[model samples]
Structures are given as structure tokens and as C-alpha cells.
Target: MASKQHRLTGTQSAIYLIISITLNALGNGITVSLNLGSALWTASAVNLSHLVGGDLKLLLMLIGFIAIIVNMILLGGIQWRRAINNLVFMIPFSILVGYSATMFNQWHLDNLPLVLRIVLDLFGIVMIATAVSIYQRVNILLHPLDDFMQIIRFKFFKGNAPIAMWVSFIPPVTMSLIAIFISHRIYAINIGTIFSLLFQGSLVGWADRHVFKTLKHQGLDKLMTAKHQ
Candidate 1:
């Protein structure tokens, strides 16, 4: 019952991809603004930005490019098209993150009480996990961080989203920890970060099963083929 992936036409898939991207950016914006925590990758970028003191969006894009190299290593070869696509994916995503964060900052989300912020942060994580589920299934082009999970999920875990998601988190968590060690201060690791580490994988798995159940993972055979190349 869970294995059959519903097919989406090209247009349908594109629409889903767009929706997921927007949802992801909005969630990221909220989490970053609230300072309650963020998805691991976003947290890593944020902590690194505090240290580096540059544009958050550009820093995120740089981190995204680095992730592309890691993804290539996982795939066992350079996937030029996939790499290029992943790079392109960052442009709109980073812009959206910047805009969303700006909008939320105007709303003063960070000024809210701790309990309210925590609840909103958790909701933001849900949006991010849902976005990951939708876009990974679309499999057209992907954010490199999510692409890492997709490769691990299908190539190593045989479509086990939870395991793959957990596996994918290791790098970002390490990145965040290193920033903390160097700065001797906490930046982005907070309640939301803890929530994501514990529940994000399971959340993605649940979303894959329930959110847009018709949109099955696309190009799995090609991914399998990429494994040997």
C-alpha cells in the first residue's frame, strides 16, 4: 500500500515543486526570525553567518554549493547535470529565505513569549519536512541538502525516508557544533534544532505517506543507474 508512487505530469510536478519551495522558504524564514531554532542546515548556515558577518543568503548559497560536492561523492561520480541543477535551485530558495525572514522580522516574531515561539518553531519544522517530502518525490531538480537525503534514501536505504533524513542531518549538525565551539556561544542550536533532530526524519516519512500521496518519487531508476556510474 505504501510503495506505489503516484505519477505526476510534468506541469503538475512543477507546480508541486514550486509550492514546496515556497513553503520551505516561509518556514525557514519563520524559524530564523523567531530564533527558537531552525532546520539543521539552516541553523548551520545561520551560525556560520554570525561568525562570518556577511549576507545570510550568500552564505547559504555557498553552503549549498559545498553540499553539492558532498552529494557527488555520495553518488560515486560527478553528476554534472544534477550538480548544475542543484546550484540553480539555490538562487530562488535563498532569495525567498531572505524575503520571508525580512517579512517575519517586520512582524517581530522573536519578541513573542518563549512558549509561543516554540510552538511556532515546531510548526515551521512541519512545513519544512512537508516541503522536503513533496520536492524529493518530484525529483526534477532539488535543493542540494534535500538531494543528499534523496540519494541516501533511495541509493542506500531503499526509499526509507526516515533513515535517509537522519543520515543526512549528520553534516549540518556537525557544522553547527563546530561553529559553537569556535564562537564559544550558542547561535542557532535551540529547542527547534532539538525538535528537528528528533522528529524531522519521522515527519518527512509521514508527509511522504500522506501529503500528495499521488506524487510518487520520480526518476528512481535513473538514480539507481547513477549509483553504479
Candidate 2:
């Protein structure tokens, strides 16, 4: 009887997991698309500033590169053993985003109305949400950002995933909020870019716990074992 109950509970959890992953994947796809769009938007905004500095662009580029490198180091340090081979996908995936951003930049957006701008941002948010979901499913390597988040969470809360995730996200969202006032100057907008990130981060955790759990019980992890190795 106990074994039967256990199986039943597992089955229910599996169903919930599948649903979560499906939702998360859809959200992630939207998020990635929006991210590329937003990058172009930000670059355009920066260009709007008449203050020109060749060195500033280079500095920003260098800083971005360092950030990525630092994130990787943090990920390796925290999820070292959890790291899997499939994490390499992030490289090509990043290139795709870069290409998409370049293409988006070539298109003239200055004349685009506020409504359209907001719409584009919405689409980007969807892509980000979808990407988060997909990451939960992949479970290959926690993104460096996610790793940094988990480490901080471990340090403070030890085993509390929610707190850790929140800590990881707060800084960026705060920065974006500041940028909005300094750069966009759009007022009375509560959601902005931060909403999508928070939504996606939450979805990732939910799916990681629920969706991935289902995959493991369904023996799907075995199919990816050789690939991950």
C-alpha cells in the first residue's frame, strides 16, 4: 500500500512538472527574443546621449567581458560537479543573440511610437521567460548568473532556493530601474524590464524543482547522459 501511494504521488508530481516545463519553455522563447530587442534599444538610447567617448564603449565592452568571465568562474566554483558537457550550448546561443541584436540595431527604431516600443519589449519578456524554462529542462550547467545566485543563497540561507534567487536578481533590476530614470525617462512604468526578469527567474526555479523532477523520474536524464558526458 505504501509503495502504491508513493507511485501515485510521483505520478502527480510528474504531471505538474510537465506542465511547468511547458509553460516555462514558452516563457523562455519570448524572453530571449526580447533580450535581443532590448540590447538594441539600450544601445540606441546610449547613442542618444551626445556625449561621445570612444574609450567609454571600449570600457563597457571590457566590463561586459569581465562580467561574463567572472560569472563563469563563480559557476564553476559552486556547481562544479553538477556541471555537465551540454553547457557549451551557451556559447552558440550567445552568438545567436548577438547576431539578432545586430540585425535589430540596423532597423531604424527611433521613429517607432511608444506603443510599439512597449510591444517589442513585451515580446522580449516572453522570450526571456521561455529561455528560463528551457534552462530548467536542460539542467546542463546553471548559467553563471544562476550559479552566482545559488552561491549567495547558500551563504546566507544555506538551503533556501527562493531567497538565493531573489538576491541574485535584485541588483540587476535595481540597476535597470536606475537606468530607466537616467536614460529612458519613462515615468509611471512599474513593470519595465525588471518584471520579465523576475518572472523568468521565478519560473526557472519552479520548473527546475517540478519539471526537472518529472524528467528524472521518467528516466529522460538517461537519454542525455552520453551527451552530457
Candidate 3:
């Protein structure tokens, strides 16, 4: 009976993956088209309120919360694995990356050549790639947005992980590009902000590698399986 149940779970997971993949493709196509406007509007609003003095940390936390909500709405549900990994990793990674970006902003280094800034942004891209590579290996839950995309791919492309993977990455990539082209007194595209994404990616990877990795390595999965039985 236990074995049969296990098999059933696997089947459900497979079905979920298929649905997620197809849905993701469609969702992403729309997100890409719509996100630019959203980004501009968001930036504009932030700029408009520049005169208001408030707690920057509170503001940023709100932004992060909004990002999470947006991802949830756009993707439908959070991927359990991704959420777990993010929780485990994002806290510290956010601190480091966020701090670094703040430092860069305060450095008054905007006067530097655009070429140098581009190089920094490239470094951030590399960081994002590294995080993606590691997280992919972990095979954990996808982020809400990723899970949604996964559903799309599964539905349309029949569980093509590769396609789902690419689709999941498009939003951040799009944001990066938009950031590069658009600039304002309050918000301009900079390598520091883009590189900050790497921190998010890295945090996800860290959680996968550390927390979940430890659980699996400690034979916790087997224990959980037994418990479920």
C-alpha cells in the first residue's frame, strides 16, 4: 500500500510538472510584454514620492513583499521547494547583496563610465547564472513564478524542463534590459542593482545546498517517507 501511494505521489508530481510547464510559457509571454510598463510605472511612483522622508528599510521590505505577492498572483501558487530554499537562503543573501548595492549607491560612483557599469552588470549576470545552475541541480520547489511557468510548460510542451527553465528566467532578464535602457534621477539602471539579483539566486542556491541538502543527506527524506506511511 505504501509503495502504491508513493507511486501515486510521483504520478501527481509528474502531472503537476507538465501543467506547470505549459502555463509558464503562456504566462511568461504575457509577463514579458506587460512587465516593462509595470517597471516604468513602479519606478515613476517611487520617484514621485522622493520628497517624502520615510524608513528606507520599510519601503524596501514592502517592495520585497509586493514582489512576492506579484509572483504569487502571476504564477498562481508558490513552489514548495523554491519557497523553502528561498526562506533558508534569501535572508542572508539579501543582506549581503542589498548592503553592497547600498554601498555602491552611496559611493557617488555614477559618474564612472557606462562601460564600467555594464561590466558590473555582467558580473551580476554571472552571479545569477551561478545561482540558477546550483538551484537547478537541487531539484527543489520552484518559486511561485517558476512553479506557474512550470505548470504552463507541462500543459503545453508536455513537461519540458528546459523550456520551463528558460521561461522562468525571462522576467529578471527583461528587468535587467529595461533597467539598462531607462534612467531617471531617482532610479537608473546600474550594475549594482542587477548584480543584486545574483544575491537572490545565490540565497536560493544556498538553501538548496545547505538546509534541504542537509535534510536529505541526514536521511530525513526516508524518515518523512516512513512517517507518511
Top candidate, metric lDDT: 1
lDDT of 1 by residue, 189-210 (tens): 8899989998988999999889
After aligning candidate 1 to the native by TM-score, how far in Å is the CA of 228 from where it should be?
11
Task: Write model 2 residue lDDT over 1-229, tens digit each, in one string.
Answer: 0011122245554454344434433433333333333322233323333223235345344434444455445434332234432234334444555565555555644346767756666655554444444443333433445434544544445435456666666654454456565655542233334554445456445645554354322222222222211
CA lDDT of 187 in candidate 2? 25
Q: Write the per-residue lDDT of candidate 3 for residues 1-229, one digit (tens) a residue.
A: 0121222245554444334333323322222222222122223234433434445445444544545555444445543444454344435444544455455556544455766645544443434433333333323433334334434444444444445545555654554444444533444323344333334344433433454232211111221221211
Q: What lDDT would candidate 3 get against the real structure?
A: 0.39
Candidate 2 — worst ten consecutive residues by lDDT sum?
A: 220-229
What lDDT would each prediction earn against the true structure?
A: 0.84, 0.43, 0.39
TM-score-better candidate, 2 vs 3? 2
Best-to-worst lDDT order: 1, 2, 3
lDDT, candidate 2, at 81: 36
1 or 2, which is superior by TM-score?
A: 1
Error of 3 at 184 (Å): 11
Name model 2 segments beyond 4 Å from true.
1-90, 105-113, 150-163, 173-191, 205-229
Clashing pairs in 1: none
